[model samples]
Target chain A: MKWSELFTSSVGKKWIMGLTGIFLVLFLIVHVGLNACIFAMDGGVMFNKAAHFMGSNAVPRILEIGLFAGILLHIVQGWSLELSNRAARKKGYAIPMGNKGSKWYSRSMGLLGTLLFLFLVMHIAHFWVPSRITGLDPVLIDGKEFHNLYGEMLQLFQGNLLVVILYVLGCFALAWHLLHGFQSAFRTLGLTNNRYLILVEGAGALFSILVPLVFALMPISMYMGWIK
Target chain B: MQHYNMNLTLKVWRQKNAADKGHFETYPVKNISSEMSFLEMIDVLNEQLIKEGKEPIAFDHDCREGICGMCSMYINGRPHGPWQHNTTCQLHMRAYQDGDTIVVEPWRANAFPVVKDLMVDRSAFDRIIQAGGYISVNTGNAVDANATPIEKDKADDAFAAAACIGCGACVAACKNSSAMLFVGAKVSHLALLPQGSPERKSRAVNMVAQMDKEGFGACTNTGACEAVCPKGISIENIARLNREYMMAGLTEDK
Candidate 1:
């Protein structure tokens, strides 16, 4: 098949989904790792240091461009696939068998992904845009100036119940999305060996739950005054 | 099996042609013996319609024993009807209770436009098969069966994959109307044997290319295809197809 056809074809769209999906999974690991620094509970010193390094580093900055491109490609490809799939089934069954044919989450990827996209927009507005563009309040760590993103997170989460709720809900959607997508991405990439497939599924299940739980906990912990 | 008689009201789809607007036409079928196959019951209905100077409902069926895979009908929102692991032709009237109202319709998919009534053009499946569904070998006397040793388990797996009858049930049953299960069966069947190794990579790539060109939807691993498959073909073949495609993409020369 030609390179152009690869993107145009249904199976090729799937390959794109799987590739970008796995890339985003890797990004989540780094993101969660950075966010987990708040557990130190030291007035954002360690957290701010890590955040500043990630924001300023040249390698991470270059990869950030690719990450945005990947996200855009994933969204475009996903919505196109969803729309075409819907169009393929012009009529629906009168007696709809919802869960009998497939798992709810597997069929609901489009909805979950849209929710995640909205959450990402809000997330970027809350921190990424302010810190990277308009800039944020700086704090001195080790006699050097850095953006106090941890302080920003604390201020954002402590008093705003609605934002906290939205963050947690965003994590909720993320968990469900990953529950199906984690293993599905690998399966699309042809990881079909029985033994390793089982292991991948087990690990995917754990990752889906744990990563989102930690993300949800960050805002919840801040709102409850546990992280102060 | 003991035979029993029953009455049924069937709401069957009726389309004059590819461009005609189809609608359900209800017909009463009485004294249907429990031992009669579903197609045979339809045969009775057609006979009655013809006697009444009405156009009989058009449906596709051949090799009434179910091996031909020519029978394609959606009964109560399921491909090949409600019975498990059986084609519509193999389905007996015994599965239905007396005075049942069964709704029968043609397979719905953009790629498979309805020809008339319960018959849809399944040439897309044929095109996919034509893309690379064969192994090229020099014409000669058949080689000894034992010349190339194949593992027992591998042979069994290959046989299972080879059981796909080119039926479009998997596509009809899929929510996305995806043909991955069908394509997977073909890919896995050939990829398992030594005779198919030479063109394995291109076969996977070209067949998938044709499947997409046919306008089938993407697979979401619903397992509906496996459930409705008369041959009980597993979704594991889909996984193998995915593996084969990815490997081909990686190894193929630019």
Candidate 2:
């Protein structure tokens, strides 16, 4: 096992997918938790404060670099694996068995992953670029300046039905992606024993449903004027 | 069991060699008994073809029973016909209707080039086995079966994994044509036994390397392989393979 073979081999690529996938899953928890502060009914005060801390903290800023790299590596390795898998089978069967062999989502991970990739780009453009790269308008709280990210969210979601819809759709893609990926990553990492597999799969299913649902709800709640 | 007759129209793939482009040739066989196995029906068709002075279809089969795993055919989009957990040789004509049109073809995968019609070279499997599919110990008088005690559950699991017949059905059934299930079966069978403990780490590393070198696709855990397996080889073997590979990567002395 040379250093080059680790990334070149099929099993190694799976290792990359699983490792990066778990890293992304952990990031989702922190992301959803930070975004969940909007439901506090404090007119974006708590949300903005949390967003400011996240954006300004030195530790998080450094971790953000690793996050971006993990995302790029995951996407590259995933597409390579998909392309090779496709190439392995030159021609398909005449009568295709669609869901008889495996689940629809399990077979369509590449498509789902691509959709999530596009959604991620759009999401970063809307929030990350405006907040971190170009800087956002400052809101003074306790005579301290903080980026009004919650204000930005309201402006983006309110009366902008298309953006809200896109956001919700992004969450939908994320949900399906996580549904297969969460358990799959663990399986790839070699947690295949029956007892632990059952537990991981159960936890994965719950996480897949809850995290995306909350992410989807944030935009819907904002658009419907449910949250200030 | 009730018996009946079927007049099947089989569109069997015909190819002279690996270099030749293959095509389907339709052959009608009337009054096939429901008791006849699928391969036996093919034999009947070939007999008819030979009587007519035409070239007979070439297929690979050793033992008519399922154990040899030498019989490889993709029948009607399935690796081993429509019957669940049955090999092509074990599939009976009773499963088909009176006028069923069966489309038979060879297992399609770049790693397995067709040597002839319905028979692709599966030496890639052999190469993988050669890579590390064995345990090394000095040969001597046969040790008693109970000389080294093993847990009943573990021994049973090892036997289950050992049941893989190197059939390549898993590769045929996979959407990606991946050979993980095959490799996993080999890895798990050896890794579970105390005799295989010495080379367990290197075995995982070497076999997987050989598997990749042979141009097989990565496993996506689609579970299709398990669905069509004649031996009912579990996907849990694949999980164990993954575990072994990871453990070997971490702990093996480089």
Candidate 3:
């Protein structure tokens, strides 16, 4: 069975969506936790130490691979589905209008997904790739050769108002994706009962809002010199 | 609390039959109650139409309850009109004003063809359902609901999936005219139960196949299905369907 033939199938595309979506959710958790370290360390020595450790760790490297796969699969599957849907609609030109009753997010997943993917590219280029490839100075924290990753991040944040705005917009796009994505992801994975669902939805909404809000604020805070 | 009669205007889609051309017909309805359900207000208007030597507009309805999902119409560009969860039949006249103009139309989807006026053929949904939705549980072999004693979590999940009224609101709400939410709800309903275990492999495949066969667009994972579903059916079902389908292929004894 060729991979393309398999993935192009209706069922195959769904698997790709779920697998990548769940992986991205996991990535979001790790990313959020790592970013939270900035608040604890106040964007200084402690933050730099943590960021250095993350960039140098084997686990982060492995997760980055998964992250790349998740991004690719998510985007490709979404676009493919959109294309297929468009083809089907074209075939049925004379069909009567059925019920129109979904929310803006559900219908716009592809567009939002595209925006999120674009943001991912910018994010990796600005942060992840730079942290990896650029041989920036190693900081001295408690007599150890710590990487000044946080300092480097602060440099990126400083006076780059356009970048800050783009990052903020990216967060907003990610939040919109998750607002619908989180609940739908639960439904996709067979967890759609009321007891857990209500709780899951609440958690999904909170996490979605909180995670992006916190990240988006970091750029603003850096620009304000609140965390130098 | 005093009651008063008020005049209203209606622009209703009218088709004599499936073969006839349809058009919006207007009528004046009087003495509407704020407490009356939205459907009851329509009943008043229809009665007037009948009395004025005109044919009453035909619409789909059953149960008059939110659960049956038989009542569906776009009121002023919104599915099921102003209220969020309630069906069009369950909507109250108080949601509108004395002189408000109401534009009522049938659910608009390529798969859901109009049978007449406001009653579209939702049988496309039926075909999707018929396509291997249930497990091979025979009628006589019915075990006690308590016998299986499914994990509380699983049972709750099944119940949530079961809440879908097949109302087609998700389809109406989707911009791409996708039926992912609707197909997802049915898949989730049976997939969570022990009764559905034996045939879970084929269930996802068949349902998705049937969905495509019926000319419904694929799920884009956009999250609109969950937003517009009156039952708030999750996109998780689509995810589950994906998982189930994958498991089926992997487990095939090839």
Candidate 4:
């Protein structure tokens, strides 16, 4: 096989999906952890400080490029896979097998991934744009200036019910996408041993739920004024 | 076991040929004994159709047991039937009750086009096998190759993979019509054996290329194929196949 077949072949495209998928999963951990700093209740001081560091740090700034590349490759390969898979089945079953064969979320990965992709656009536009591109409101903390991203989060969520609701829905989509993608990426890498698979499945299930729950709670907390 | 009977309404797909568009034709079959296998119940339906001067439903069934894998029927939206790890011939009527409506159809996939009623041409699977599903031998040493000591676990897994009957159930049950399970089984079955060491590099790559050439879809790791597999072929083989193909691609001898 030619080296190019690594991306062009079916299994090769899946390799792309799996490799990039696991990478993005790691990024989600960093992202949600950073966002979760809002519960510090120090009037957005901690979150702003952390956000400023992540935004300004040289290493992280460089890693951001790789993050975007991973996201783009995942989306492009996922879309191509969806199209080809659709073409493989020319006829439809009379009575569709709904969750009898596999989970509905597993079959609907393409749709869920698309949903997450759209949600990501909204999320990046609202926060990433201000903090990174357009600049956030400057707040002085501990004799240093930092971008008040938490202030932006509060401004967006507290008064606007729709934005909060949309954020919650976005997290919902992320949960479903992660539910299938977590174990799937491992399976795609041929992690077939039942012993290790059980652990990955358990950890994956917990991570998928907890990560999204934390992300959703940030908007809900700010909207409901749960945190100072 | 004291057995009863069922009068079922079967919605079977009927297509004249590969080019012919198919439709479901319902048939009421009475006095189907619960003791009879699913195929025998179908045999009753076919006999009735013959008496009524209608063309009997054409399906593929060789070994009346589960091993042949020739019996291909998508019963009630699942390949084979409702029973877990069972072929159509092994599916007994006892699972169904009287007045049940069972929908039967040919395997739906672009690669396995409908050849006739309830029978899709599965020659695509054959072509995939012909690609690299074998290992070349020196032809003088059957005993020497057989004596190679394989680890118990690897041997068991390979035997399990080798149990695949090539029924195309994996493809039929897959939403994508992906044959990864089928190809994976073939690849793992040979790759596990020391006798198959010679073609290890080429088997996975060549077979996968042929599988693509056959127009089968890519696997999405849904586990649907494993769920409906009559042989209970594990999706682990697919993971192994993925590993094998990648290793082969990266280390191919140019």
The digit string of per-residue lDDT tens for model 4 on A1-228 reads: 788976688888898899999999999999989888898888988788888889999999999999999999999889999999999997889977667778889999999999989988988999888888888778889888888888888888897999988888888888988899999998888875777888989989999999999999998998888985
- The TM-score of the first chain in every model comes to 0.97, 0.98, 0.87, 0.97
How accurate locally is residue B237 in candidate 4, as Cα lDDT from 0 to 100? 90
Whole-model lDDT values for every prediction? 0.89, 0.90, 0.75, 0.89
- Model 3 chain B weakest 10-residue run by lDDT: B219-228
lDDT of 2 at A29: 98
lDDT of 3 by residue, B124-229 (tens): 8888878886667556876777987789888888888888889997776555567777776777778888788877777776777777778777565555557556
Second chain TM-score, each model = 0.97, 0.98, 0.92, 0.97
The 10 consecutive residues of candidate 4 chain A with the worst lDDT sum are: A92-101
TM-scores of all models? 0.93, 0.97, 0.71, 0.97
Sort candidate 4 into its docking category: medium
| Residues A87-204 of candidate 1: C-alpha lDDT, one tens digit per residue | 8878665545466556788889999999999999999999999989999998998899989898899899998999999999999999999999998887777775566788888989
- Tens digit per residue, CA lDDT, model 4, B122-186: 89989988899987766675576457899988899889999999999899888899999999999
**Residues A80-136 of candidate 3: C-alpha lDDT, one tens digit per residue:** 887777655432212222344445666577888999878888887887766678777
What DockQ would candidate 1 receive versus the native complex? 0.50
lDDT (tens digit, per residue) of candidate 1 on B220-246: 776788888999998889888988987
Off by over 4 Å in 4: B144-146
Q: Which candidate wins on lDDT? A: 2
- Pairs in steric clash, model 4: none
Global CA lDDT computed for model 4: 0.89
Top candidate on DockQ is 4
